[model samples]
Target: MFDSIKLRKQHGYQAIRDIRTATVKAPFRGFPRLDGEKCDLSCLACTAVCPTGAIATEPLRIDLGRCTFCGECERGCGTGAIQFSSAHSLASTDRNDLIIQSGQTPESFRETAIQSRREIHRLFGRSLKLRQVSAAGCNGCEMELNAANNVNFDMGRFGIEFVASPRHADGIVITGPISRNMAPALKDAYLSISEPRIVVAVGTCAISGGIFADSAQLDRSFLDEVPVDLYIPGCPPHPLTIIGGLLDFRRHK
Candidate 1:
């Protein structure tokens, strides 16, 4: 596949080398490397599901450029071998330099999300926090998101947290379809969050009502109830994507 001069010229030779190096070297690198702890390195779901066979078990490597980060491997792994990290510092000058996985546990990841939430709250000088509402969701999205606050994802890492009271929140995170029964509650919550604040729609359901589009009890659009600053599109996006969206908002503000 490397024979095309035009393609090679467009991407440069160094970029390709760096990508290969990252894939070969990544599996050997341990998590918490700074602490001298080694990853179990026992999980191989990424190898099995990699559409292009970019991941391999014998050498334990991943071709960065070829990786889709679809979280298929992470989700499929029963042992949590492949994981999402709060570390988003994967940018590189060379196209092939992106082969490493940060391997952050759900615990560390949540901690970072919480920390960001708190910082944003503090910046507003508000004692209140953010509220999360579920519309006509399959419960998978809600469960995954709620899981972040448990010991695993640890939403407290970023100082941002979820609150039970809408009045206390600076914004609202809505997940799933806007069920007819929940419409009033969703609207009330959106209105309760203080003004100059924002709303975030998570998952395909909240954005487009998703698979429940034909359900008589669900609304077609959630934006009708609240102004959304962000729309995360996924059946249930990985927790990292949700965190990334929030952090992006933080940076923009």
Candidate 2:
């Protein structure tokens, strides 16, 4: 009984230390604030809904990394203490370095992600330039790939301009199973791209035919058509992951 009490006290002390550490290392200091008098909002909803516990009272702040960029806090804030900025340098060598302060609202986070995609597109250049073919996919991967170019995920930022003709493309983005029916089309697409090209096999279906592993109709081989530069193995990888893979390709080139 005495040992149990001692262990409990030790855990309590550690918890207090953690809180203290977080307080001292808090990233947002002197972030801008609205004139509460000028704005007649009565509720502090941001404080209640922040998923990461990144927001604070006394003066409002946000740790960007802890934030999922989900915009929940901004939506919850009635006084508009939280906001988004187009600052996408949320990456860091140190994991803790991604914290940021915008003082904007949740609406801003959406704008920021959009703006970031735009910047990525601009940097990558605006040319309809890649051919994508799915061999034996469930369509989920294709939907996400399409969404990257849609208004929300906005894949055009990395200059992921899709092309209808393989001859006009710089690379091939493949998804789905390498079904026998699609094999000829996939091979043709790979062959049609110019030299110094790339192939990205997206989703587990394209990589290994996923659930269709034993199906005789599925080739179960991405390499049969062309040499793959990147393999994104997910049931259907997120749009951001697709973008990241493209960006990584750019870095290598």
Candidate 3:
């Protein structure tokens, strides 16, 4: 028991005291800030180096859903057209809203980010149990999702957590591009869960196939079969970003 107390002091209170308003202090690039005036149509430098084609020039919009948050565009652009910020609350209910247009700051996105899915709130009632499907991912996003449930994030305190079985879950959290091999298994997992279920596309791969959209090995039929309730945009979204989205989706905020 004495060892436990010492461990507690050494670790301190790791979880964010207030997940809703907590700001990330690290050199993490959570959101991209776009400047249309600085964007040069002739150069097209940003688009050329973008691995996932997340950036488009006509209206100067960066789709967060496809973004890996690698900061490649910021480095290649000389006009300061794109700069990434530490603002991490980048989840949304609508897929279209993930597209960040020029002159759109993190603050601007926050205004519409989580529109409070009232019906979901009524269905879940401030608690959720999810079954996560790796779907042949690189494991970066999978590691981050595990981190979301750790002592530091402590998402369970809010009554949100992952379950071992789909039968025991309120929904399924999908990561990675759904490979052709995993398609049938992914469908089976979803079918195991009860109705009034939620589907969350938690990373760039699951949302828009990330860097593998053109790859022939992916079969993303499950995405078309059901509507995604929340879209968390990041290579692997921050733990705060994930938990906060779940809370906002359930209208806990």
Q: Which residue window of length 10 is worst by lDDT in model 3?
A: 117-126
Q: How do the residues 35-130 of candidate 3 rate in per-residue lDDT, one tens digit apiece? A: 999888789999999999999998898999999999989999999999999998899999999999999888889888888866787878667899
Q: What would the per-residue lDDT of candidate 1 be over residues 1-253, giving only the tens digit for each residue? A: 6768779687553322221122223322211111102223565655677554435544444443344345555556565545544333222212232234344333343333222344544454333256888876778779868765655345556666888888778888888778888887888778777776767777656765555656798754447544555555445665545555465445423
Each candidate's lDDT (Cα)? Answer: 0.54, 0.55, 0.89
Query: Cα lDDT for residue 234, model 2?
Result: 44
Give the worst 10-residue stretch by lDDT in candidate 1: 28-37
Q: How well is each residue in 96-149 modelled by candidate 2, as lDDT tens digits?
A: 322333344323432332222343244344443678897877888899789767
lDDT of 1: 0.54
**TM-score of each predicted structure versus truth:** 0.50, 0.49, 0.95
- Model 2 deviation from the true structure expressed as Cα RMSD, one decimal place: 21.9
Candidate 1 Cα misplacement greater than 4 A, ranges: 1-128, 220-222
lDDT score at residue 197, model 1, on the 0-100 scale: 72
In model 3, the clashing pairs are: none
Give the residue spans of candidate 2 off by over 4 A. 1-128, 220-222
